[model samples]
Target: MTQVATTDRALPFDVEAVRADFPVLDQQIHGKPLVYLDSAASAQRPVAVLDAMDRYYRNNHANVHRGVHTLSQRATDDYEGARQRIAQYINARSACEIIFTRGTTEAINLVANSYARPQLGNTSEIVITQLEHHSNIVPWQLVAAQTGASIRVLPINDRGELEIDQFEGLLNDRTCIVAVNHISNALGTINPVNDIVRIAHQHGVPVLLDGAQAMPHTAVDVQALDCDFFAFSGHKVFGPTGIGVLYGKENLLEQMPPWQGGGEMILSVTFENSTYAGLPHKFEAGTPAIAEAVGLGAAIDYIVALDIERIAAYEQQLLDYATERLATIDGIRFIGTAREKASVVSFTLEGIHPHDIGTIVDSEGVAIRTGHHCAMPVMDFFGVPATARASLAFYNNRDDIDRLVDALHKTKQVFG
Candidate 1:
């Protein structure tokens, strides 16, 4: 319930005050002040999130849902309270719609195994975009491999935006589901999800949004978008890793079977047959990441107190500045230049591998993610081996971008 300092929402957001909350950002790395900009991979957790997890373990540590003891009740309260916070974070219809998973990977896999597996037949198809992370893509491929269903990809244009014009042509009576990322992690393109959902719904196909990158950067309301399923990871939103949410429409969840079988998911078991539990618990089986869930709840509280719309605006400003600053570097080519973007910049310097760029930048205490970004298809389409990415957060300042630019200059100097 700690607020991340109200910095007069009218002004450009106070980035320093926001940075102060993340103690990990305070220290120097390799004798230079750290300019940690790799937020798209995983955001730094605030002290608020840290303390929340610590307090949960210290005071209310117990097995959830089964025990009738005092600690169990409190643990259950904390665990389920976290679920409520997640529901509120995304404006889900009910708390029951929120199911806990290890991360976005598990959440998508859960939907694939539980929902998509049974629904998809030999002739059925699953529609996805070229912009999907490996988490989003691999699950459907596994589903396709298991079921006789086929996978169709919606192509991205040269600008790295989803080609919405060609989207409808890929859909037909055989389409089972359309899963796309809310924001491309590799490109930072904000996909037009409302339009995607609307078009998919027209074909009577449900849609799932991979929202791991989107939840941290934008305001998401499941009801407003009317997406059938949404998945995101806690670590991407300044929460602890190994905890995430899967939000599904109530009616659909009621129809889908359990993805995993174990302790919490079962109602009763006879030798012959076993009955399943209801709604979310039906999906969340075994001992969940209880402390991580508490941390995620605290992270949501922190993000909410700061306000997401204002966060988005401030981060947009940072993105603009970073883009302009990086473009000044000689021999640099930008990737994924969509008009709509989050605070992530993906690019490469001429004749310099991204790994070398990352290593050189790290020595100067500037951190940036460099790889295919788990979107190998994206890399393939762009005809590049990999990209160097500087993903930002609200906590980042212009100084971080400046340091990154300086480090890249040094990289070029070394190459020269």
Candidate 2:
């Protein structure tokens, strides 16, 4: 770990040293120094993650699990090594519980098709919260349509937080699964997942958490949360894209059938008899994302070195600073005001479209996310078409927030 000079900053961690690790942040955007604030969508990667992927492709690029040569063995080791690191990162019981997919969307869809679909009957119900991203919601909807099952949505309060009481009432004997986001990508509301899991367990329901937005900011212990299944994306964790993880309990994975049937997932194949492989591989079909997995492992290493607890505390400070600064602007209404949140600030500027805000900000070399943020239902609940979202990460500093506020003022000026 590279150690830099310790300064008298609000955070104990060295933000300057951390920012130095991200090479992309060094460049200018639109002839101005870039201030990236859209980490919830996808975070910028560190040099370590980039180097790991490059090393894998250059030295250990080969198909895994069926290798006879030296390259094959190395590739298999690196790939499975990534899985082990991921398992440890999330505190999974074993590496066999970590199934790789394209991203979180595919992970949720796998559970929807294999686990939920088989158990669901005509009268069965799948319960999900309004805070879920489209990835979590659409899959269950598709499975429900196929199996003649019904979908039930747990409501959220005006503050954009999940209604725990409503969620408890929605779970019944007929409920097949309870799916929700660990943190809202659009709102930054941290759901009470521990309570969710405990309540669902009482009704004999399994809970699946979409941890895509949560992985980058906070520490997640699957064992501690006691969720039946958890899904997260690699790209959001400062890793390369196209690789993600789906963790399932040992017993549940053994019973669930494979969602896709292709190369790596099967043990023995025949015209009449095709037996599937065990736990993790049973779900991971076709050629896996080898280089991306190595990058994800490197990303995990970076986070472990930094210490997630410290990162979370520092980011909360950033969120607070940004919120306080942005609040001074007139006609600025915050979208999510949950007592508990991560490093996301979403709001609407009166008499201005979010798209225009995003466009104007980009000109000033300040990046922000604009739109319904793939949670259109949240937009409907707030009665707004879209919002301007500035999400932070460990790398972001006070300067980034200042630039964003200045850019918003410019947007207001232009719109007027």
Candidate 3:
């Protein structure tokens, strides 16, 4: 991997200019410059995103798709405009296929409840991987319990890469769905989702990719991947919290029953029977997060203004530099070493609990995630309770990695 030079023109976007756009990054923690490296959990929003939401609430805040007033019309346009932008961001076929939800967790649960529950039978099996977050795991379990279906898990190796052969073996006639993460939140292992989708589709099974971690770092084309469903959180992509997207193939989405019933999701409500709405509106219940959706559009615009390839290249360099630095530290054991990985590093120190390590790092103004990260199965596979994770983004630079390494050394010295 090539190291990014401090004077590289490849990064057309100025780091200082970008940093200035994020107000939160200017703060001090423990009397030192804050080093935030948990983008996988949530990304810091730019001024554009914050301004978009503020602008919406200030001027165009109104209920969508209902009122005939001008404010309602503007709000509806902005809200639907955000959907269109998201559709283009992920290269989905149509805006009708995109349904906004709370986040990735709710998106998966929507699929499990609406599609999997209706289609899967008593003997049907839902195959997922150990790399999945609990959001991806528990929903299928609930669906299985309700439908008399079973849940099968694909295992991983010590390096935290998925066992592809085992995954292939598990795809049989009885498999109804395959729910996997595009990138592991805990390990940063970028799974071969295209292959997983192809294999599952061969058995006439649909695949749902949890793309929370993958969307921020790479470009995703739902059409090219040909997965039945893809889901991600807006907060994970430099957008607002409490807003996410669920993208399904048009046919698949049309076939799935509406998961929730309320005002916007309904066409006609009688005392006896109620008729549901169509496509995206069918899945979106009650009043949607209008301002947040508008802010997500602005976030997408901010990302679009930057060259994605350049951003990804810069992030890869950061990952490599961080990995090399961590490797040189004694007693620092990295949990994930997949051939293809992302901008996340999960590790543990020999003599320190992950929480203790996190506390020490906090003292140095370095922020990292320390826990199972909602992927306990991966922890079980690795034979550890939890590992400290430093998930990076394009805005992060080499200086952040230096701070992380220095903090890790201090953690070891204090604990050892």
Candidate 4:
């Protein structure tokens, strides 16, 4: 264990110091120090995030935006303040453009239901890439089925990069919405979202970007990208679960009908016909995740304080080191070797199932995600059922990569 300074000045955002801030990272798993390498799935929360949530629950635990009481005002201020922070973090035009949801899945569902269903009829078509997660793919499929619209998939090359030429070819006047991921969760491929948005706008189609993976490693400016809609989960960015963000252009959100109708989403209610609330409240139905939103706010503050560019550089170094080490292993074969990628490294060992490799790694206190990672189409494209994935974060170091490689060597010996 290392002593971490609470002082504001720290060089390179010390990995050991950051690790110390996360209490869970100090513990031993299976009698060995825990090496968390699955941050792309979910990141470990620091003391600051945990303490913020705890302080909120202990001192101010009340529903937001309904009551005129003091506690309600405080809670509502905190909740809405989180929205403002998210707006600034992603550089959206206004706070009204940001809506809170359970996570990235609900955000996409909101767009699919509110925007796509009514506007897009039988003749319309929705385009997506083959590398999207189930969250991004399934909702569009459901909307297409119900509305009698067609679904089109943009193919990817063997390196797991989207075929940009094919993507351009797929867009046309009939395309209603283009949904794609900013970064592939399974393959770590960072798609050219700016180009994607520009191409869709040229065809008069709205684009929705799933930033669940990209938000953690890169700075996302929705306004700069000129994307109509963007969705991301808080848990992937070191915040609590059951909280996420959905950013949409104000005019677009205003035009779309409410997806889920409940208490807060309405303006005036009558049995005959009820009026809906304005921009964001129209989309956020029921009581929102109050404390979780506060935790997410704290998480954003933590990341912003550290500066994203430095964190990205450090994580890339770890990625390069891990890639070199893994390439030296005789039976290891890397998957998704895209030129522009995030910190995720997915690979397979000859004559071994991904599940078996994951089990062996876990025995040595190395946590790596395995299986299709909720992207079955990506797996099918790579001609494998699944691959072992070791996703890196800023706090991880070369020693973590060493642990994974050593565990993999032990796995080969055991199976041989």
Candidate 5:
């Protein structure tokens, strides 16, 4: 956001240098060099993030914001310092807008209950797109079920891109909120959130963006997008798991009730009623993920140091190369071919199950995610059970894609 680290003085992306930071990428799998292509699922963290978490565990293992001891202070600082770093990274108006959660799933769920449920009525509608991951889809379903509101889905074209022409028609007086993914994890289709937000706001409706896939790939300025709520996970961005962020506009967050109740979320607890804390802390329920938060901060540091512009360019090259090479393979029907996309490639082979493709690739030490990619609706639209997805990261090189190609050849041979 504010800190995109895209200065012209930044150095070119040294692929080897970036690769060296992730020690897990150096190892072998199934007696072959590992070619990790599953970043869309969970990215491998660099040593900086790992070390940061390790340092916190070793030197500052204590409950945060509840004690006067030195360790407690250290832990609290580390945890809150992470919030500040994340806020700065995403260019939030204030650190108070960032709420920590288990992951994007919990983050979206928090808004579903706290923000949407109370506002929705029998005649209300929640608009989401077909490109959404299940995390984005199911939360709205639950809230709509509770409030007797209906869920309206914006359809996607054959290329897996949202049919932008239809977006305006979907929003009416009954539409309360529009939730869509910034980038589809399954299809890598980058949705036009600017248009989505502008049109939704014109109808006096708020928009929430599922930004899990977009956070790692691009510079995200929430203020620039002007979305009401944005959710993303740290694990998808080379940070530790079990830590994520929900960024809401200050005015909207102030009006919403706390989704969960417990210590730290409350200012005072008594027999009469418990008073809630303000801003971010009100949503963070219990002893938060301190080490993970610190690791997430370090992950942001690592990404910043490398410069996001270089990373995006390098990854685009990888995607282009992989797409060209994979197109050479026979019966390789691309599931999603959006003009604007991230590094993800989802495809299906003729008469070959995605699981079989994944299995054969694993034997070659090429790891890819093979499933509906948490977007079964996407699969249903394409009339496929699942797809083999090779998602690229900045650390990935041409050799990784080559290995995947060789593995796919083997899969085809085995199937034939």
Candidate 6:
């Protein structure tokens, strides 16, 4: 993969001013200022997103594509407009390539069932990495089971980065598709997706990226990566729950059959004979998440107004600072120290269960995630049941990291 050189400079936006945009951040938890650091799970939505959804429901609420009334046209415009904005945000070839789903999990399941299931057989295999979230892993497992095919795993190293050598060896003629996460949600390692896509394409296989974590921290150009499919959740990117995107290459989508048969997805239907709609609407069935799509559009607009590159740089600095400060605490073991990462730090303190660490930190009003992080294989790789994860977003600053460190120290004191 070719590396692009960029200048290292401070983020341009005033983080405090940006923090004011999120009303939830200006509150107290346990009588202390709420220090939210678990953005990898779900980010706090700004007022723009909230207001967009509110506006959509209050004024333009209607089912899309079917009604001929004024409200229907307005709602349809907002929904389709959101699709276009998302396509531009990701540099997709056209808005038609985007398919709306419940979230990343459903998007992956769509590909697994619609595209891969019919193509795979007893001789075929599916390739994934050990670093994948449960959402990315489970769908393929179900596909393999139904088809009598096998599943192959690309292992990760001690640093939680994929072993590329093993990955190359695993890709063979029997490999039907390659599915992996763009970023490890459990460890924050940024996978080399461009390289992964190139390697898979060489063997006549397509790749699908689970971008739920990566989308919020960095810009994703699906065209540049050349991946066949990409999936991400709106909530993870500061949009709304129950809405996400699945972007597929137009040619591939044309070849794949619709996973669900319902209202808007079809052009005409009788008892036995049915015809499907074109491009995007073929995959997007039913009434769809109208307000959530509008909310996602507002979130995209918010992110674009504050440049994505600037957000990436700011979050990197937060990760570096937090890593440095947390390293000073005694007996704190870092779970993932990848050369390339996003805004997440997973660690475990000496002689303390991760749940205990989480509970103690919560008492001090610091929010962090403590569990297997929906990647139990990752936990097993590090030989721990779970780790305490503190993820960052652009809204976070040096003070949030300091408070987290102080809380960790307090946890140590409580345990002692």
- What is the C-alpha local distance difference test score of each model? 0.94, 0.92, 0.90, 0.91, 0.92, 0.93
Candidate 2 residue pairs in clash (backbone atoms < 3 Å):
none
lDDT of 2 by residue, 173-233 (tens): 8999999999999999999999999999998899998999989988999999999999999
**Distance from true location, Cα of 174 in model 3, Å:** 1.5
Q: Write the per-residue lDDT of candidate 4 for residues 1-416, one digit (tens) a residue.
A: 12332335455557777777788888899999999999989998878889889988998879998999989999999899989999999999999999999999999999999899997789899999999999999999898899899999999999999998888789878899999999999999999998899888888888999999999999999989999999999999999999999999999999998999998999999989999999789988899999999999988888887677778887888899999999988889899999999999999999999999999999999999999999999999989999999999878988999999999999999899
The candidate, 2 or 4, that scores higher on lDDT is 2
> What's the residue-level lDDT of 44 in candidate 2?
94
- Most accurate candidate by lDDT: 1
- Per-residue lDDT for 146 in model 5? 91
Provide C-alpha RMSD values for all models, in order: 1.0, 1.9, 3.4, 2.0, 2.5, 4.1
Candidate 5, 1-416: lDDT as tens digits: 22222334456667887788888999899999999999999999988888889889999989999999999999999999999989999999999999999989999999899999998999999999989899999999999999999999999999999999999999899998999999999989988999999999999999999999999999899999999999999999999999999999999999999988898999999999999999889988899999999999999888888777778999999999999999999999999999999989999999899999999999999999999899999999999999999999998999999999999999999988
True lDDT of residue 115, candidate 4: 90
Query: Which digits, one per residue and each the tens of the lDDT, describe model 1 over residues 131-206?
Result: 9999999999999999899999999999999999999999999999999999999999999999999999999999
Model 5 TM-score is 0.97
N/CA/C clash count, model 5: 0
lDDT of 5: 0.92
- Runs of candidate 3 exceeding 4 Å displacement: 1-13
After superposing candidate 2, which stretches have Cα over 4 Å from the reference? 1-11
User: What is the TM-score of candidate 3?
Assistant: 0.96
| lDDT of model 2, residue 412 | 90
What stretches of model 1 exceed 4 Å from their correct place? 1-3
- Cα deviation of 12 in candidate 1 (Å)? 3.1
- State in Å the error of residue 347, model 6: 0.5
Question: Per-prediction TM-score, please?
Answer: 0.99, 0.97, 0.96, 0.97, 0.97, 0.97
